[model samples]
Target: MSALPMLHRAVLAACLLSSIVAGCARKADLVITGGMVWTGLSSGRAQPGAVAIGRGRILAVGDSAAVAPYVGSRTRVLTAGGGLVMPGFVDGHTHFIDGGFQLASIDLRTAATPQEFIRRIAEYAQHLKPGQWITGGDWDHTLWKGAPLPRKDWIDSATPSNPVFVTRLDGHEALANSAAFRAANVSKDTPTPPGGEILRDPRTGEPQGIVKDQALGLVERAIPPPPPAERDSALARALAHAAALGVTATAHMNASWADFASYRRMERAGRMTLRVVLYLPLEQWRDIADTIRRQGQGDDWVRIGGCKGFMDGSAGSRTAYFFQPYADSAGYYGLLQHPEASMRAWIGAADSADLQVTVHAIGDRSNAMLLSIYDSVARAHGARDRRFRIEHAQHLRPEDMPAFGERGVIPSMQPYHAIDDGRWVEQRIGPERIRTTYAFRRLLDTGAKLAFGSDWTVAPLDPLLGVYAAVTRRTLDGKHPDGWVPEQKVTVAEALRAYTWG
Candidate 1:
């Protein structure tokens, strides 16, 4: 099944409804039958049906009788056995290249203890050449007994010879072993990058190994990038993994120029299996816009024209800027990834150049500020069709919630984070603030353009997992059986639209 772009996938049955009634002359390349076919229509209805696909496009979609005209002797028939035949999922957010590399790098997302986390890295390093950097361990410290952040000393003995910068699943923070600090020339004296923080031991003022938000770049610069061959291998694994999970395309949250080159190489070779829409960094808006104009927007296979910026860190990292202080820690808000003034200027210019702007805003304050800036910029510029998006609109103030739809801002969200985060979100913020967290049903009801994704490399890339979380809202810890923030749970069809459409 080809997972093409969503706008093209819109109205799955429109083609058949309009033209297939008279039937076509050519036989279908493939026919899917014996299933509840979801038309992915605005009506949000499904029925027993069949579909015919040919030449990389949806040929005819409807009941078996409606599709029989296109199926012939050579046409392939796929019986769903009463399963679902819906449009392929288009993940709204992801870190594609990182996800690809993480496929073979390490498995730390499930490391239940600090000891297990260090042990996994040590075990993986045993096979690597000495001094080689270890990257891409999406570990979640929250799963540990006390939910303590991992420190350098805990892993230094295990990884004495290797440099390590294992990221938390949220992508907002990382744990760097001692070797990595030396490699990056970081010291107790090194000033934290603007909009970033270095967690340090109080008395000695020594680094404790946790680097949040922008500070992650400090160690990242020292890590040698994967060679072209290794990148190709990673891409191969990523495409296969995505296809296996029924993901047809992605709106890559934070991609790079190097990553774009790799995608182009694959596209030119006709091996690009997954459709990717890359949102390069927002800081380099000039280069991003210039490149798009010089090369022309790519085809359905790969595309460019968007830039992603970050407003604040993630909630799990305690760096997602909020209206109030964290319940557990007083007088501390989240870290901002970019200054508000800089963000405003960059977004305005990018929009003027016709570049789509989607930014990361996980905290309530950041989300509110982002909405204001986007609204101001759109008004000042006298917009044509600027589809501003708030990536990870994770938290919201009730008053600011309806502005998303009123201003036509797209809430590009990840549903899986709700259930996973719900496991301990109340510990970070009080119960009152939890109501609007991942407000899926509320946003949809108010007419916001809610687009859902997995935030791959941070969360599972599986759309079904996201769907289950959205529909069920059951926390992973088994608490809140009725659903975590149950009022936010949406219907199956709404989740499908966010996955398949915008």
Candidate 2:
């Protein structure tokens, strides 16, 4: 063959290669079919359907009969067997890393009483190295017959050698031992920070070793950060656990850009199974703004989703900022973490950047302040398609009921928090305010988008558990047979939407 003929043959081969590559790129690798698919589309349109996936993108979704033709010889097929195939659940508020950390720690979630709680800690303490931080035992003592708070005295002997700090399931309060207090350099004389509290012995005028709300920082600062490898291992376990529960995505509530970087690395490595949307703290607004200016905005699956601000703490801790006094504790209202002005500024910047904003507001006053801030920011931003969220919209004022929908704010709530908090909320907010607290039905009726979440590490990550609680309104102890605040109950469909579609 002549040199010119050989060159012509090479050119023809190159053209064929390009054509084959384009054809392969356009072909779908898999098709899912034969399911009662609920598309979650508006106007209640649904049918026996199929979805074709190509390169991880949905190629098409429609009648299975029509989509079956797209299945090529090489395509993998999945039949749903007439099962309900809905969009994967999305948790709008979670602490992914904290959830992972909890998974790796000693679980004391079933500790029925203070004694059992101390025993569990004592067992965990025996295995730890000297001077190591004993962390993440979310022990709830409210289930005790008298619903008493655990004092340091009982756990002192159990964990005498090891420094111990066990948080309440809600994370609003914690019990620390003498060793932990000494390790953290905290004492009875140390004044509590603003918006926090230190429980004290009335007669002795000494610290009782119970720290509430913002006071948890007194002990947390003493613990060190986990290594990168340890974090990755825990995160892997957390994602697998999430997948088993039918979760496809989640919105992390208090993640930093550093955490976002870790997520990105996981995504690139194909190790991340669930879609993640991270919310940065409001304190890092300027830093995030400068970074966003350089890198531009992110996408739906994994993005710098929003700014998270705290308005108050949990009602269980009597630290949820409210308008009125607690019946038991005279003149006591929960602490307010941020002022309206500060919250407003955070919202304004987040809105302008088109970033979603989610605020943690568990008390009536906190919820009211959040609503006011959302209203102002929405007005200033003009007509926009932003999804503003209010995390843990736990308590509500009657007058502020309509504001949630009117301002187009989403109530990103955790239903388990209601079941957990309902038992003691009345003591903190009085009976009148309790009527409107955890009003899921009322929020939906007033036109708010109620996005359900587990707030894992705070509650179990099982959406079914949450759905059961929302529909039943049953307290943790099941004290109220008919359900606690039954009027606040939501239907199965509404509860489903909060977790699955909202």
Candidate 3:
């Protein structure tokens, strides 16, 4: 053997040290390679690259070759194979528990005609015991070719064996049979509750089977609450169904404290697969302060997020409080779900408790009222980074658009609503206000953070369908080839961001 020179030995030591240093650096547990990765980064950039995940957090993101070294021999690899690899999408708002119940309940979504609706209910009633309430038919008469609103007489004769109460798709209206009316003891003499109306026949002045807004509560109060076991099964089935649809995260809107406990129990047992963010009903905030103070903001998976308050009912039901009168009923503006004073009080409480507030404002007046309340909160809170949200900011005045961005309010909107409601929206608000209805472009232009969702049970939970609707503004009936309000059309990328981690 030849003796090594000092210079050569020093060079060899340097090479070994470099190897050791590189080996000691952090390594990734899993590295996804060979795909187009849209990071949903602020810059909105996409590159052919790889992502490195260790334990749970992302370790690195760079070129495939550079990231490959971090992948250990034990690591499992996923080859994207030219597919898009993006962050899991987040449905900013939904009613998961209610949606779960809807999945299990009597579905009336497809009864195109009033006769067809009666036939379906009669079919469902055959399986039930006599006098047992046949609940949960989310029907819409507007979808029928002639678009005629049905009366009690239509379903009364068919479902006479069983009492039936079917909600309108928007939950703003309900069609009840005479059997249901008799059970609830509702009569023509009964007075409508504040902020609610029972549609009556013009000729005879009798209850016309349609109950609008808070009037639904009259019939709803007659139905018994679901037992705990039934709720559990519903949630389990919902989680499984949501997982199948590629929904990794969801936010349950307008849930009460009792509902939150169910979610917490499910999460603790590791039975929940999708991430859930619960929003307590605004009125129930005082009851959950201690629980929320301990839990605060949630992790990436399950959390108690905020409170949801209703400012107005939906447009389809003619309960969405408008500045001007509805076309069908002159001098008859829609009702407000919450008074301005009541909204201010609830919002102030939510702010004080450090809870992010999400208000449902579907009409221009409702939207404006919410904006004013949010503006007040901003001034009182003094520029804190709390991300307040406006659930279903569906209708707006052009002047009020900028307030959303100025106040940093995230418009947690449902795009499917526009497509679903657009077919008949003109009849409700007339042509002029309809221009500002479902104003996605105007909201975006004002720099409002538009967070998209399906509202699930109200519409389909499939986010892809929502993306198509938002980008195309296509009515469900396929009426407009050019698109409903084509000017409000958003890009595929913008719709994708609203559904993605955004």
For model 1, how does the per-residue alpha-carbon lDDT over 243-313 read when each residue is reduced to its tens digit?
99999889876788888888888888899888898889998899988888898878888888489999999
lDDT of 1: 0.87
lDDT by residue for model 2 (240-280), tens: 99999987788887886667777776777888888787778
Better of 1 and 3 by TM-score: 1
Worst 10 residues of 3 by lDDT: 1-10
- Per-residue lDDT for 1 in model 3? 3
Per residue, candidate 3 scores C-alpha lDDT tens digits across 1-502 of: 0011111233323322435324535677887898887765545667787776665545556566556667788777888886777655667778888888888888899888877888888888888887888877788888787678778888777678677888888888888888888888898888989878898887876798988887988888887778777888788888877877777777888886666767777877878777777888887777556676776655655677778888889888778888888998889778887678988998888888877788888989888888888888778877776678888888889999998888788888899988888888898888898888778888898898788888888898888888898999989878987779989988888888778644
RMSD of each: 2.2, 9.2, 9.3
* Clash pairs, model 3 backbone: none
**Best of the candidates, TM-score:** 1
Error (Å) of candidate 1 at residue 18 is 3.8
Give candidate 1's error at residue 257 in angstroms.
Answer: 1.0
Q: Alpha carbon lDDT of residue 392, candidate 1? A: 88
Name the runs in model 3 displaced over 4 angstroms: 1-29, 42-45, 54-57, 201-206, 294-299
Could you tell me every candidate's TM-score relative to the true structure? 0.95, 0.89, 0.90
Point out the higher-scoring one by lDDT: 1 or 3: 1
